[model samples]
Target: VLTRDEAQTRAQLLDVRRYTIDLDLTTGDETFDSRTVIRFTVRADQDVTDTFVELKPAELRSVTLDGQPLDPETLDENRLPLKNLTAGDHELRVDAAMRYSHTGEGMHRFTDPTDGETYVYTQLFMDDVQRVFAAFDQPDLKAVFELSVKAPDGWTVLANGITEHTDGVWKAAPTPLISTYLVAVAAGPWHSVRTEHRGLPFGIHCRRSLAPYLDADADEILDVTRACYDRYHEKFEEPYPFDSYDQAFVPEFNAGAMENPGLVTFRDEFVYRSAVTDTERQTRAMVIAHEMAHMWFGDLVTLKWWDDIWLNESFAEYMGYQTLTEATRFTDTWTDFGVVRKGWGYDADQRPSTHPVAPEAVNDTASALLNFDGISYAKGASALRQLVAWLGEKDFLAGINTHFTRHRFGNATLADFIDSLAAATERDVHAWADAWLRTTGVDTLTPRVTGDNGTYTLTVERTGSRPHRIAVGLYDPDLTDEGRLTLRERLDLDIPQTDGRPIGKRPALLLLNDSDLTYAKVRFDPESFRAVRNGLSGLPEPLTRAVVWNALRDAVRDGELPPHTYLDTARAH
Candidate 1:
């Protein structure tokens, strides 16, 4: 495994200019032929240095630096050393027989059981890029990649840029400056549905066996894609960075989806072989929105290292749900996020393995990979959503646009992001980053209420250091309907109250974090708790209901509310 220090050392020493990779997939089923020519320049001030390229090849065929031959036997583990390199432009060429993956890591090969047709795509996140092509495999050493593939007679190849097939080879358009992990390729006899959206070619692909399924829902899939694209453009000042947009539903994909510039790959289950619910369809749309956001957040402006991966994922996750709500028919995506996704974050945060949303340091790649857990995606996004609630969307978006404009097609860190937000608003964003991003575990907010029938005071007691701007829902039983509840008023409150505020004429239930705009675990006042036990299902919005249920769940987990009580409450509601 490559360490962070090693990646940093290599990144500072060399500026990778471009990579020309040729993949021959016609050779056999077990392995494919990979030839990579890397053109780079060592820093002018640096002395003669020895650096290495990474490739996990089955057989090392040949290696050359400049025009000189190097022993293929010198390959150690995944690294091939380029020894005694001076400070100037150099081209290193590596030819190898790379094994195909069944584990869905690198160059994953799958044969559909339905048709006995084969397909292969790359899932090269982080270190897995070495499994496909040899290069300086770090996020900071951005480079233009030109890929050419020789595949089976009828197979179609997809890549980071537009692909064109002529004669016997498929050549992709050169990509913009991007990390090795972002370079993608999928080749198979695919059933494709193609269209033109805003002068750009948009397409979806799947294996021949799933052609009918792809065709059945092609219109809906495309509709979501186009809606998300338009919505993202409306939010971002920067237009779409890549040339074409292609989403390929490949089989045996390890991740829900990967944001690979122009060609995003999803697990083929999203193609839907069987029946699915409307919520499930909404989830597919959310995933589409998520990956598209990455075209701007992760692909366009990338993180400098793995430690700030939340900059990629958290933004995408938040933007995914938010955009899906705004632009698509799925208007209650955040309700789903609150009910399902937020639980993942809360549970992970409570674990012994929990780490900060953006930890102080990730010493190596192995540790960095571990950070991709719930904290990065769910908790990190919750923090961002909270930031938006506090910072206000106008200023939040301004900061985002400024961040993009400052670091477009380049690398940035957590500090850089905070500085951008600081520029957009006068609020203490750096302090917020310290309290939220640099901290682990969820904060617990328990409400305390006092006073009489028509007059009351509400106090929110926080058990953690993070500041929150949350909504307090005041619900009353409907005058006519016995089981229904009416929204009396929704009060906005900042945590760590100066004093118990006079909340005149408190309703039957007082729910905290009613809008699901924050990350903290909230609790109800005694009256609110009693009301929730009786009328939780009567909450007007799904989001409010989700918040109330989550509070009850936390109460049960903390032993404040008995398991049987929760079950009985669930049954009663």
Candidate 2:
């Protein structure tokens, strides 16, 4: 594993210029030839003697530093030490035979069971970049990447940039400053759907076996893609950072999707081989919107270290659902996020392995990879949603645009992001970050209501320290039908109340965290609980019902409410 300390040392000493990597995939089935030439400059003021580049190869054929041959015998495990390094510019070339992987780590090769067709794609996330090619494999040491691949006659090559095939060699356009993990390659006899959206080439590819399925949904997929692309362009002042956009549905993908600069890779299952619900299609659209958002949040401006992974995922997650809701037909996207995705975050947060949304420190790469769980994506996005609620969308977007402007094509941290947010608003964003991001577990908000004559005062009792700006919904039983309730009015309230809120003439029920704008376990007041038990299904909006259901689920998990009561409520509703 590449420890954070070692990465920092290498980053301090070397400034990578660019990587020119050549892969010969026609060599064989088990292994392929990989040759990488790295040009970097050592800081003149730093007296660094030696540094190492990482590569996990089947056979280390040769290595040369500054055109001087180095013994291949010196290769150690995943690291090849470049001894006697001097300051100023130097070039390092490595020639090796890299093995293909079946476990979806490095270069994963998958053979279709039905037709004996072959497909391969790189899942070079985290330290897996070494499994394909060699370089300073860290997020902070961003560099330009140029790739040339020699594949079989019928294969198509997809990469981080526009790829052109000429004279049997496919060469990709040089990428902007990006982390090594974002370097992607998927080569196969793909079924491709191509189009032009807003003068940029947009393509989607899948394996031959999934051609018909891919074709069936290609128009819908492209529609969502175009919608998201346009929406992101509007939200982010930074124009599309890359030359084109391509989404490849590759086989045996480990994660749902990877945000490679111009090429985003999704698991081929998204092509849909069977029937799916509208909600499922909406989920797919959300994923499309999510990955497109990464084109700016993750690819354009990356995280400095693994600890700040939330900077990439959380931003994308929030932007994905929000953008999908605003720009596409998937207007009820957050309802799915709240009903389906939010539980993942709450569960992970309560686990023994739970970490803060942004941990103070991730000691090594191994520790960092584990942090990609629900907290990083779901909880972090929820925090951002809450931030937007409190800070207001206009100021929040201003901070985001400022963030992109300040660190375009670079890396940033949580503190840096908070600084960006603080610059755009008068609110104490730093305090919010400390309270929401630096903490673990969920906060409980139990409503306390008291009435005098016809007027009622409401107070929220919080169990945790994080501040939340939430909505309280008031509902009244309909005069025509008691079982059907109508929304009275929604009240916005902030945690740690400064003054008592006297809401004149209380309604039949009081629901906290009404719109699901914040991340907290909300509890209904006694009257509201009774109303929910009788008419929970009367909540007009799916998001409102999701909030109520989630509260009951949390109560059951915490043993505050019996499992049978939850089940009974579900049965009745």
Candidate 3:
């Protein structure tokens, strides 16, 4: 059912040239009509046979292809069949009506109880692209989409590209090349803040009821966007590929955000009608950066299939944090990743559903959907951070740029990405890929120290199959102050004992897993444990303090330590 050869052959046989989609948005009976025209070129070698299109059965009123009525008996919920299709080049058109889904799948219609204003939007999860329109829903069948909607006079419509309005109808410019799931549209009486940066239009929007809150944070939000955009320009040779960039905070969005080319849709809660912490603002910035990266990685050069989803998410995660740190005011972004994000990786790695950062095989759409979890986003990000440390930032970036250049406006596989990286770096990136990306489970680091004749020796024993390049810190007791530890030396070492020699000098406190740069669980020696209990707050580095706080947080969550005692310890510190 999940054959790579079949998918590759299918991709080679079909090339979608254009799509003209028309939607009527003013129906009050919770149903709407849609008509789609898909023009494509077929490979010369392919013979006349059968073709299939995906769509939902219950919502479909009727289907007609190429102005000829299709047999109702041939219809099903997932796929429609056509016999004796010619191979050279062809056009397939469809007309149907779709009902609103309450479970957040497709064409969701909701009325705000507070203001009595109604809104309509689309939320196409993993394989729900068929619920709204008829098309090839798989990732490999990349296509250009042209959307037009007829809505009420007062409502505004947003889509995957720049939009132009005429006679109460909104029409979006055709998108470059994108997957079916990334297509999006929202129509409502919206509140919008518009501006221009670097000759490109930029805007942020929300529901009319939340206009004041959006206005309050407009400057900060747009500043973050401009900074990240400028930073990405400095890093890559290619400029931004899309036309206009807009971010909309829509209601009841299933995910944090969907990277829908020019129009990125986010959950309306980000408008922030209530009080929020600084950490929440940082999170919002991070998601913005993440979705922008997808405008290049996933939208421009896509993965060939679902199995290489990590290629999209992992690259975006790494770029999101690093770019924001280099270009925006959120310079301490990795601190949050260590304290909150990497902790997610560690917890999920210990669960039964854990998989490698890049799994060897995914049999079908159902299994591929399950892979989009902590191991894919968080653990994959940690692995990439380690890769940068091992390969150096310059070469890592060079490798990424090459990958993008070679695969621009096309689809690539995991092996193709690895080959590009191997070409850029002289290091054993191929070997590193095998040990890190292809492996599962978390590593454990244990510290052992022995002191004799004023000489101290610290030896680290690693207990896992995966290899790690980690930072080890050494601290000494400050003689003037009671229970205070002072920094002594920091050592960068590769685990699995590459040199076959013990690291010399027993530190007064040997801190394993320092800097929180890698994904691993650290166990402290008796002296280091005592130091952590008493002097954690005295550490000069906030990142180090965050690591200790995370360890205590995990201990409490796992019930290894009483929650009240952990709180008491934090209170005492």
Candidate 4:
């Protein structure tokens, strides 16, 4: 396995120019032929005299560097060594036979039980793309890829770029500079639905057996896609930087969806193979919004190293829920986020394996894979939401536009992102990042209400290091309506104290983090806690109810409240 230090050293020494890969899938056998031609320029460094390309083929074949033959014995494990190279442009080609994977890691090959048909799709996360092609196999050493594949007659081919089929051969349009992990290909006799939206070609695909279900929900799926696409354009100054948008719903996919620039691959289960609830459908829509957000945040401006992966996923997660709420029919998306996704983060943060949202160090690809947890997605997005709240939406959007404009089609680090945000405002964003992102564990916000002579004041207790911009809701029992509470007021307040604000009088119920605008474990004061125990179900807003329920649930887990007490609260409400 390649370590982080090895990949970093290689990237500094080489500048990849381009890659032209030719694949022959004609043989009716397990192994297929692969021929890769990589052109690169090496830098003038003392330790850069030799480097290696990566591949995992079933059988060894010929290797040539600038038409000079090299011994196949030099190939070890998945790396092929290039020796005695000068500081200039050079071409390295390798011809071998690679086998397809049954697991969804590499080039996965599946045989459908219903129709006995075969399907091939690639799930090359991390270093698995080398199982199919020979390249640098690192994100920072990006290159344009031109692909040519010869598949069986009457089969469809999809890749990261636009693909066209001619006589017995398929040629994919040269893709923009993208990392190897983002490259994708799915080939078979797929049932496709094609459309054009806003002058860009759009497509959805699935296996032939699931055609009926895909057809049933085709309109809903495409509607969400179009809506998210348009909304993202409104948010980011950079336009969509791809040829077309293609979504393929493949069978037995390990992930919900992958944001592969122009080609997005989703699991076919989203096509509704069985009865699904409205929540599930909304999840589908939110995923659509999430992957579309990646089109700008992730695919356009990628992270320089795996350590900054939170830069990709966290931004997408926040945008996904936000955009779904803004654009699609899933209006109360944050409620689901509060109930489900936030819970995931809270529980994972309490675990022994807990790490920071953007940890100080992700040692290698192995550690980077471990970083894809609740902290990276939910907690990180929560921090971003708080940032938007603190910085204000206008400044937040301005920073994001600046970020996209500056790093489009290139790579960036966490500091670069903070610098962009700093440019937009005079506030200390670096300090904010330090408190929220550089630390692990969740914050606890305890509500405190003080009563004085004919008046009251409210203060929030912070249990963790991170600062929060939260909203406090005060509700009074409705006089006309029996067993219902009406909102008295909502005050947006900063944790750790702010300018004095008036609280005219106490109310029937007081809720912290009422709007779900921040991420924290909230607690009710004694009076409000007793009020919730009696009348939890009578809360006016569903989101407020969700926040209250989440707090109660967390309390039960902490043994602060009994488990049966939580059940009773559920039963009462």
Q: Candidate 1 lDDT, tens digit per residue, 1-573?
A: 888889899988999999999999999989999999999999998999999999899998999899899999888999899888899999999999999999999999999888888999999998998888897988999999999999898899999989999876999999999999999999999999999999999999999988999999999999999999999999999999999999999998898999999999999899998999999999999999999999999899999989999879999999999999999999999999988899999999999999999988898889898888888999999999999999999999999999999999999999899999999999999999999998888899988888997899988899999999998888889989887789988888888778897878978998889899899888877788888888888778888888988988998998899999999998988
lDDT of 1 at 490: 83
How accurate locally, in lDDT, is each candidate? 0.92, 0.91, 0.81, 0.87
Top-lDDT candidate index: 1
The digit string of per-residue lDDT tens for model 4 on 239-289 reads 999999999998888888899888898988889978899999999999989
Ten residues in a row with the worst lDDT in model 4?
A: 42-51
Per model, state how many residue pairs clash: 0, 0, 3, 0
TM accuracy, model 1: 0.99
lDDT (Cα, tens digit) per residue for candidate 3, span 259-299: 87788888988888889998899899999999999988888
Which order, best to worst by lDDT? 1, 2, 4, 3
Pairs of colliding residues, candidate 2: none
lDDT of 4: 0.87
Candidate 1 residues lying further than 4 Å off, grouped into runs, are none
Each candidate: RMSD = 1.0, 1.0, 2.4, 1.3
* C-alpha positional error of residue 260 in candidate 2 after TM-score superposition, expressed in Å: 0.8
Q: Write the per-residue lDDT of candidate 2 for residues 63-132, one digit (tens) a residue.
A: 9999899988888888888987878999999999999999999999999997988999998888899999
Clashing pairs in 4: none
Alpha-carbon deviation at 346 in model 3, angstroms? 1.2
Model 3, position 489: C-alpha lDDT score: 78
